[model samples]
Target: MATKEFDELALDGTNYPIRASNIKINFASRGILNTIEEPNDGDPEIEPRKLNTALFLLRLYIHKDLKHEYMLETSPLNLWKALKERYDQQKELIWPEANYEWVHLRLQDFKTMAEYNHAVHNICSKLKFCEQEPTEAKKIEKTLSTMLPEDRILTQQYRTNNFQKHSLLIHTLTQAERHHELSLKNAQQRPPGSAPLPEVHFNVQNNAKNKKGFKGNSSNNPKNLTGKRKRNNNRRKFKDRKKGKGKDKAPQPRSNGNKHCNMCGSDTHVAKDCRIPKHLVLLYQKSLKDKKSSENPRFEAHFNLTHEERLEVASSHQAPVELESNINVLPEDVAPLSAMDDMFIEYCSTDPLGDLQ
Candidate 1:
C-alpha cells in the first residue's frame, strides 16, 4: 500500500505535491507512522526506516528549488508538513480571478452542449476538490438558462417536464438540437412556392373553323389570286412582241403630247401599244374589275359594256397556243390551287395576322 501511494504521487509530478496530512493519515492507518527520534536499545528501527524512505522519494520527485530549501531537515515528517503549508499558502494567495469569473459569468457563453458540458464538468471537479460541489439540479438550471434563444421552447418544455436527472436533461437537449438541424435541412430542400402551374388547352374546333375562313378569303382575294394569272398574261405578251405579231412592229418614239400608256402610266405610247408586260396589264385590268364590282353606282354603270367589247379586251391579252414543247412541267412545281389554298390556311392559323390588318 505504501509502494502504491508512492507510485501515485510520482504520477502527479512536482507541480501537485501530495498532502503531508494525507500521507500521515494513510501511514497511521497502516500502523507504520511514527516519530524520527532515536529509539532505545533493542527497539526495531522499521518505522524510522519507513519515514526515511518516504522522505527520500519525496525529495526525488519535488522540484530542485524546493529540495534545496527543505531537504536539510532531519525529521522527514516535519519537512513534509512545512512543504505542504508553504504550497497551500501560495495556492490560497494565487487562485486565479478568471477561474472564479468563468464559474459565475462565462459558463453560459459556451456555444454547444458538448462545450458547455465539458466546462461544467471541469468546474464541478475543481469545486469537489475544494469540498464545495453544487447539486446536479443547480448544474441543470445553469445549463438551461445559458442556452441560445432558438432553444427557448425546448428549454421551457424540459422545465415543464420537471426532469429529475441531469443526464436526462442533457440527453433531451442534444436530441432537440439534432431535430432542429434536420428541420432546417428539410426547409432548405423544399421549393419556395406552394402553388402549381396552370394547365393550357387549345380549342381545336374553333381553330379549324378560323383556318377554313382564312383559306376561303385567301383563295378569293383578288390581290393575291390574280398574280399567277397576270404572270401568264405577261408571258404571252412577251412572246407576241418577239414574234412581231402586233399592229406596230417598229419601235415607237415617246409621244410628247401627254399620250401616256393607260395600262402602265408612261408617257410613251397608247394603251394598245404599251410595252408593259401582259401580266402587269392583266393585273391593272383586275384592279379595274375590282373597282367596278365595288358598291359605287358610277363604277357599276361604267362596267356595263357590250359583250363584243368584253370579248375584244379578253382576246387582246390571251396567250398564243403552244404547238409542242420540250420543257415538261413537274406536278410538284405546279401545286394544285386547292393545295395553295390549304397552305395559306395553315399559315393564317399559326400566325396572328392582326398586325397585318
Candidate 2:
C-alpha cells in the first residue's frame, strides 16, 4: 500500500540555507526516496510529476543567480543533490566561532519570552544541521541564563523542577508575563497614597437665607439690642453737650463744603458722623488725651479738680482731633485686652454719663 501523501513543501528564499535544506531532505525521505533512487519505467507520468513538484518548490526558494545556474539540470534528484552541495559548501565556509558568538550575544538581548524561544530554537536547529546539536538541559540552562533579571527566577524554578519540555516552559513564562502586565496595569490605575478628597460645595442661596435670618433675630439678641441702645444714648449725650456749648458762645459760620471725617478719611461725612469701629474710636480718644496731657502737664497735675471745674476746661478748649490717615487698627491690637478692661469699656460706652460721677 502507498504511504499517506505528505503536504508539499513551499519554500521562500529568505529562510536560512540550513533550514531549507532540511525541509527538502524530509520531503524526499517521506515516500519519494525509492522513486528518486530507482525510476519506474512503467508509469512515466507519476514519477516525473512528483520529481517536478519537488523541483518546482526548490526553484521557488533559490536566488535568481542560483536559479539561472541550476535550472538547466533536468533530473529532480540531481537538482536536489546539487542544491544540497551548494548550501553545504556555504555552511562549511562560515566560521563556527563567529556563529557561536553571534548566537550567544543575541540570545540574551531578546525583549520577550516568545522572541527568545524562537531565536534559541532557530539557532539550535542550525547547530543540529551542522551536527553540533546541544542537549535539552543545556538549551534550558542557556535560555534561563540569558533571560532578564525578573524572569530569570521563575525560569530557574521551572528548570529546578526538571520541566525540560520547551513547550511547557514557554507556556508558563507566557502566563507569568500576562500576570506581570496585569499587576502593572492595576498599580497604574490607582496611584499609591493618592486618594480623591471629598468635595464640599457652598450654596450661595443658603448663605443669603442665613444672613436674612440673622438680621430678623437681631432684635432678640441681647448684645445687639444693648449696642443699639448705647449708640442712641451716646448721640443724645453729644447733642446735649453741643446745646450747652451753643448757649455759652455764638456758633462760628459753618463751612459750606463737604466735611472730611478725620477718623474714616471720608469726604462724605464729618468726624462726628464717622462709623469707625468702637475699639479704634476708643484708641483715637486715648491718643488725644495723652497728647493733651503732654502739652499741658498742669492739666494732669490738677487731676484732683472738682467735677464741675474739669467739665468747664473740657468744654472751653475742645480742640478738633485729627486721626492720621495711615493708622490701621487690626483685630490683634484689641485681642490682647484683659476681660476686666473689655467689661469696663463696654460699661463706659453704654453709660449715659460722659465722665466719672
Candidate 3:
C-alpha cells in the first residue's frame, strides 16, 4: 500500500490521507466504488467527536424548536402520526434535523406537563397504541405536581420510544375535572334532609264498640282482649261478610288457574292471549312460531283491549277499500266531460282485446 501524505500535496490547507493499497481501485469494470476502504473501515460506530459534531449540527438545524411549539398548538392525535413516521425512516440517523425537530416540536411547549408528555407518546405509539410507559419514567415524574401519573409514564414511553400513546391525557383530565365538578354540584344542591329514612303510617278506626282500646292489633298475652289468631280470624270473617257470602258458609277465593304470560307480559295468557281475532291468530300462528323459533324473534303482545282500543287497532290494520257506493255519478246536466275525454276513450277502446273485451 502507498500512502499519500498531506505534506506532499501542493497547497490544500486541510490534510487528506489518500489510500493507494495493493487492493486496486476498480474504476473500470463496475462504474462506482462500493467496497469499503481499509483505513475508514466502515465500522457501525462513528468517532465520539464526529457524533458530537453531528448532534450539534442537528441541534442548530432545529433552531427555533418549531417541533416543540407545534406540539403545544396542535392536537395530540396529529402529532403522533408525524413522530412515528419520522422515527421509522431513520430520520434520526440520516436527517437528524428533521427527526429532532419532529420529536422536539411535538413534545415540547405543551401548556401542561401532561399535555407535553401525552404529545410525545402519541408519536411513538406505532406498533401498539395500547403500550404503556415505565413506572420510573423521568419527565412526568419531574413535573409530578402538574402532570398526571399516566401522562408522565406515557411521555417517558414516547420520549424513550418504549410505548405507544394509548389515551389522550388532556381528554382524561378534562373528563375527570368535569366529573368532579358534577359530583360537587350534586352534593351541594341536594336538600339537607333529602332521602330521610322511610316511615310507616298507621291508621286506626275506633269501632265505638267499647272504650279506646287496641281494637285491631293483637297482644301477646292470653289475658289481653284481642289475640293474634283471633284478630286474624275476625278480619277474615269481616271480609267474607262484606262479600255477602253466607255467614256460616265461608267465602273461598277464585281458583281460575290463569297465569300471566311471561313471554309477552300479558295477563293470564300465552301467545293465545293476544287480542288478535281467533281466526287471525290461527292463520298467523305458524309465521309467529317460525319467527320465534329463529334466532331473531318478533313476538307481539296484545293485552285485553278496551272497545275503543280494539277499534283503533283494527281500523289501522284494515286496508282501505275503494267502495263503489262512495263513487259519485256526475249528473249529466252538471259538468260534461271535455272533448279530450272522448279522444282518450276512443284511443283506449281501440285496444278491445287488451282490455276486458
Candidate with top TM-score is: 2
Per-residue lDDT for 1-357 in model 1, tens only?
A: 235444222222333423444565665675556542335789866666677776765565456777777758867667666666666543443345324843574434866667767777766654554456678888778777776688688678878998777778877777876898898887777576655444454477667777675655556788667887898899998998788755875666756776867797667777787778889988988888888866453323333232322354432233435657756655666876666664645333321333322
lDDT of 2 at 79: 71
Q: Counting only residues 3 or more apart in sequence or on different chains, how many pairs clash (N, Cα, C under 3 Å) in candidate 1?
A: 2
Q: TM per model?
A: 0.38, 0.42, 0.18
Q: Tell me the lDDT of candidate 3.
A: 0.41
Candidate 3 lDDT tens digits, 1-357 = 433221221122011111111112322133222222223556454345543432332222221553454435233223323333433343223344333433345333465436655554544332122232233343333333344455677456534643223244345545755787898887887677697544443232333433365445334446454566777899998996798855566456443457654344445455555565666555566666787778563344543222322354332233334568836787667656674465545234433235323
For model 2, the superposed segments whose C-alpha errors exceed 4 Å read 1-60, 93-108, 147-156, 193-357
> Relative to the unseen true structure, what is the C-alpha lDDT of residue 261 in candidate 2, on a scale of 0 to 100?
72
Q: Pick the lDDT winner.
A: 2
C-alpha lDDT values of all predictions: 0.62, 0.63, 0.41
State the displacement of the C-alpha of residue 24, model 2, in Å, after optimal TM-score superposition.
3.2
Model 3 residue 91 distance off true place after TM-score fit, in angstroms: 5.5
